[model samples]
Target: MTDRRLASVGTAAESRLPSRYLTPMDLVAMFRLPSVETVYQWRRKRTGPRAFRVGRHLRFDPVDVRAWVDAQRKEVAV
Candidate 1:
């Protein structure tokens, strides 16, 4: 079963996710940006949300994205 497989293969948090992860294009859409280049730049600069590579593709965890947004909020508010 999907539930069993997910639980057995993933961490507890990953198992709860419902097939959603952020790609560079997803970041562009989330920020209403013009291109995914900005996301790649952020990765190169190490100044954006934490990410990981899945083979040749980059992936951002939703949890890390939320935390990054929160950090940005605190940074700008101060």
Candidate 2:
């Protein structure tokens, strides 16, 4: 199989992901909160910042997520 196929199938066998990436759980932990389901909902709604896709897996850049969180903090502070 091709490298692309391997990345799409072999690596993501566990979660049916097309690529090996962070899950909603991983992100929630990084954010120090408990809102796994909400995060997934936000992804669907497209109102919770942005994310990236690798094959069939959803991934968030740590920097982008942190930046988004910072923006939220600023809004709340205001």
Candidate 2 wrong stretches, greater than 4 Å: 1-21, 32-35
What TM-score would every model get versus the actual structure? 0.74, 0.59
Pairing residues by index, what is the TM-score of model 1? 0.74
Worst 10 residues of 2 by lDDT: 12-21
For each candidate, how many residue pairs have backbone atoms clashing (under 3 Å)? Answer: 0, 0
- Report the C-alpha lDDT of model 1 over 15-68, residue by residue, as the tens digit: 543358789888887789888998999999999999999999999998888779
Clashes of 1: 0
- List runs of model 1 lying over 4 Å from the truth: 1-19
Among the numbered candidates, top lDDT falls to: 1
lDDT per residue as tens, model 2, 1-78: 598997887445434322334567777775665688878888899756578878887777655665577788999999
Give every collision pair in model 2.
none
